[model samples]
Target: MNPRDTEEMTATMKRELLCVLLLCGAVFTLPGQEIHRRFRRGARSSRVTCRDEKTQMIYRQHESWLRPMLRSNRVEYCWCNSGRSQCHSVPVKNARATCYKDLGVTYRGTWSTAESGAECINWNSSLLARKSYNGRRPDASKLGLGNHNYCRNPDKDSKPWCYVFKAGKYVPEFCSTPVCSQEKNGDCYFGKGLAYRGTHSLTVSGTSCLQWNSMVLIGKINTAWKTNAQTLGLGKHNYCRNPDGDAKPWCHVLKDRKLTWEYCDIPQCSTCGLRQYKRPQFRIKGGLFSDITSHPWQAAIFVQNRRSPGERFLCGGILISSCWVLSAAHCFLERYPPHHLKVVLGRTYRVEPGVEEQKFEVEKYIVHKEFDEDTYNNDIALLQLKSDSPQCVQETGSVRTVCLPEADLQLPDWTECGAFWLRQARGVYNAPSLSFLTASPFYSERLKEAHVRLYPSNRCTSQYLLNKTVTSNMLCAGDTRSGGNQANLHDACQVNMSVSPYSEPTPG
Candidate 1:
């Protein structure tokens, strides 16, 4: 697939400073009410709980696995040659059949023999999973070794495989299972190869790949990211993957016995998703006053003021690709001509240009066809940057594209919400999380981020929203605690988001 087509990562939600800010600081508006503080700290008495759609799907998938496996043949094997070795049998609950290639990821059958007709070594064997390969014990949960000697594929192998005793040592061999077919590459991957599940463990120079869940490689990639290894689909087996938004599938390989990262030389059914830059060495840091370098994907959008010499801050956008900026549809409802708008990338200050900043004129914009100005439903817009070159902006220290969210992410109920700020004059307010109800003028010149939390679906219903229609796409967030920062929020966005006396007819 074209990298441009794949780079529409953040375009999924189409948020900007004003839109994404959502209710980070809780200046929400209901149709009949002037303004409503969407959040109030210590007010969980009336709060409703919610489980996102992804959670429901996974729960359903697990329920489906129970029925068919009970009818399959159960097997038993002795796990180790050690004095403590004991014969164990497959547990009924974990037994699974692979009907499709994608099912290979979730396959948990009790087939314990390898292609060489060798008995598969039990994962619990001291010489294998229990021993430290290189400073890290082989991860059992990551490898999906559920006690039995069942053949499994934790790595993206051609089919289900396991270690077997051969030639005085344990070696890996494929198993003939109905779950994952021997044909390796049949609908095995997802977009841009982030979900690449091929058996391409060799680098361009034919170096063998290290296990993705290897403690050494996990610590090398980013120690902080180790916890997220499973979430990124990195597991026990070493297979080339694009877990961190790289241009192509890659893995940590041993070169001259030193661990290093390299791109896999294996070719796929489709073209690799190319990008303008490589993954950064480290993750961005967070604080009250967000530096532009921490938010490389941010775009400072502005409108050419027809009545004045200078432009006015329109809205904050996020870079999805080298040439595309995703923002709210309401920001363009005025129908401003493309020539009248500009997008500044890699900017530090909101107004004063940063040394690494790159500016581009707006080429054109495409808003959701069903956008509702009144309800802000389908409130997404994509702006194309006018540029002479194909890559409108180069990926730099202060400029990069954000990865599109594909997996469940498994965020908590109180997910962090931030507002990307844009102000006219250079001013700094060392504050936390920002929000807005309307366009405000008194924001600080420095890019500001506000810490915000998500609200349950019940709290953001039409009855609570002044009878305005609320859609699934529209998220409600806010700061529940009312404290010293209220003054800063009042002055920062300069928005009159305070609740009106009449708006609050009920005591609750």
Candidate 2:
């Protein structure tokens, strides 16, 4: 077919954009246009049987306007539940916080494995095929739970826990999320951290910290964070702390879960520069969309709403460590309380449950003290995940931390790096009736990476960068190919729905 045919087809398909108030428990997509039409017809019959006059009226009012356009071969479709009870209209808000810390309540990130290495049982699973349940289960959406078996803390437990099928019973098991008694800020270590008493018990590689006092230790749990135990800062817990005067904080954590103790991967506080600085990569230049296998350090962040039900996707982050995520300062401009954020790692798909996904509650929030929202300088923020035991997140094949680029490290110009991007909108503005379809959040449902390159510093000067001021801290990088040479990068700048760590080119 010629380009004219494609143009005509696209124009005809988007002739009318209509918003049908389709209500449903979860977003469900159709296999193809043929299936969508078939299912849409079946949904029409629900107008009366479904007993939802209001929704039927709203759909029917636009049906006449949408009939001709819906018949187009190029259109896609997805049917929603006819019941009003199942429908949840998410209030659209400008995303700010890089993460959210809830009461272990509406957790949506996919972290399904239990602390005991047991896989969580799905909420909608038929394992309890019998009529009565041992305990009442809350609505899956209440905790941002899909039908999948991802772990969540519904009862406001000390940490996120899920039920595992044991023998004939569903036994509850806690995930790696920090418990209230043992949770603490895992980010900073000041002046040897002698007085820091929070329990953060894991090594950088997810190893449990060894107790200074071997006698009173029960498991990796510290009995007292006291100096009287005569070891180092052996206290009630084996959390990471600096009892001995060292350059940075260190602890004797069990290496590889063995009896032998080895100390490594302990976070060193950045005494000089800030750890929140984020390198901007607008779009992947040559590569379009890659997956977690390629960019294991990529992280997705979300914020919980107090007045609303489901969590909202806020921004993308780079996992610098197991317990810390780095994003842009603008992502947290609204000044969301530290507890309103949670980070998800190892999730290949935005909403789909990943088998090895891990979720963490934010324990500390740090934005650049000198951030300039106007100039976009210092556009960085750091989120500290609450420590549960020792490590906040377990490293997985799809969820490993990225190494910090060395200051003295040398690389050639145009050095390519991984990037996260949102799909740009096509100029297919149909009639105002279908505005919802044009702005639907369902597009780009999976995690993707784009290839972007590091240009020579001399070439990225103010004269070459659209006359924007080249701040000392700012880095200029984006796709420069013919079709992708648009100056702006990162979808958060355009879309009001989903946000990502980004800043305007430092204004001249």
Q: Which candidate should be chosen as best, given lDDT against the real structure?
A: 1
Error of 2 at 250 (Å): 21
lDDT of 2 at 33: 57
Q: Count clashes in each candidate, considering only residues at least 3 apart in sequence or on different chains.
A: 8, 27
Candidate 1 lands at a TM-score of: 0.38
Q: Lowest summed lDDT over 10 consecutive residues: which window, candidate 1?
A: 495-504
lDDT of 2: 0.51
lDDT of 2 by residue, 238-314 (tens): 66666555554456654445555433354433332122322333433223344564456667788987798988777
Query: Per-residue lDDT tens digits of candidate 1, residues 1-508?
Result: 7786666645654655557566654554453243223345554323333222322222211011111234556433222222223333444435533232553655665667666777777665656744332111224434556455777667666677777778897777777554432335633333446656566687767788887667676447632256455334466678676778887677887788788888776543321122233223332222244566666777778898998798978877767676787766777879999999999887757667888899999888877778776655666677889876544676666777655443343345445444443221111111222211123445456665555554455665666555656566555545544433222222232211111011101111
How far out, in Å, is residue 161 in model 2?
50
The residue pairs in collision within model 1 are 9-404, 23-477, 31-466, 41-480, 98-179, 433-450, 433-451, 434-450
lDDT of 2 at 434: 8
